[model samples]
Target: MTSDFVDVQIANRWLTSCLSLFGRVFGEDSAHYKRLNEQFPSYPKWPNVEQAYGVLLAAIDDFEKEALFSIKQLIEAEVFDEFLDQAEQLHSSGYFQPAAVVAGSVLEDGLRKLCGQHNVTLPDRPKLDWMNSELAKVGAYNKLIQKKVTALADIRNNAAHGNWGEFTSEDVTAMIRDIRDFMCRYFA
Candidate 1:
């Protein structure tokens, strides 16, 4: 398994916590502990340590996927994907201005969702920059990300204000890619 989403220190703590809990139930030197160790051999050692951590993370991911599927069954949130899809279609059809507007809306919605997830309060009718600032205050992203988001918001403003000469199709393509990556990183 890959360590792309795994942190060693965090994994160590989780494994330690798991061992402690299991120990309390099964006793440290019991046959159950031995059998469990056999299944997940090498607690805090290299290779196996990361492998064990990956397994734990994978299980969590599986659980999250199931939960999201169940939640979707109960409530529809089709706007998120629809906005991105419309942006992509507009961009592909050479309607750069409309594409940028839709893409900007996607980014704005993403920021709002991020804020809601973190329980960060936001002003009514908050703009992209304001949402970005709130997210930064809560440490959702760093300075570099803020700067990039600022640039995207600027392009978005130009597009929304009918400043078509300010950006080209190429620019919109980059914006769409950036938003896609941002969504995958934070919302996927």
Candidate 2:
């Protein structure tokens, strides 16, 4: 499998989530009748477990395609240009820590926006790692890009923790450049 867009694990999880919701709506048994002697129905018409599972998988496959397509359109719509410009200016002004933070924010915000565009729910206060994991599960970026985003998150965390010794101005400059490229490549 190329794993270009559809992530099987994510799709499976999506199916599971849908099943859980359906279970709450229907009964866990998904039974429409209590017995053959019953005249009225206990539940509405419903697919059998196997049929429901298959239907959910097919529906999720289609939903994933729609999500990926919408994500591409969202990325093409120049969503983070201002953030990039600010990060670049801060990087050029010798504010390495601030620049790195801004750059990291750009990445985080971009990911959040991408998820929202695709109807993917995230945590109320999502950390960079969480955001990155969700995006990775959806196959938004390849593993290499996910790794790069991790490094960026580390840099941002260190700066936020007042541990500037871990990264220098040059490192922040590179981060700014990388973030700019990342935004351009994914969400221009």
- Clashing residue pairs, candidate 2? 78-188
Can you write out model 1's per-residue Cα lDDT over 1-188, one digit (the tens) per residue? 44444455765676777566546544577444454354453334455555555544554575566743434422223456677789989989889899999999888888888888778887888889999988888899998898889989988999999999999999999998898778777765
**Candidate 1 stretches greater than 4 Å from native:** 1-79
lDDT winner = 1
What's model 2's overall lDDT?
A: 0.67
Evaluated against the true structure, the overall lDDT of model 1 is: 0.74
TM-score of 2: 0.56
> How well does candidate 1 match the true structure in TM-score terms?
0.59
Worst lDDT run of 10 residues, candidate 1, spans: 68-77
Task: For candidate 2, write residues 60-163 as lDDT tens digits.
Answer: 57556674455455544454667767877887877778877877877788778767755669878988898787788788888888999899888988888889
Tell how far residue 184 is off in model 2, in angstroms.
1.3
Reference-based TM-score of each model:
0.59, 0.56
Runs off by more than 4 Å, candidate 2: 1-79
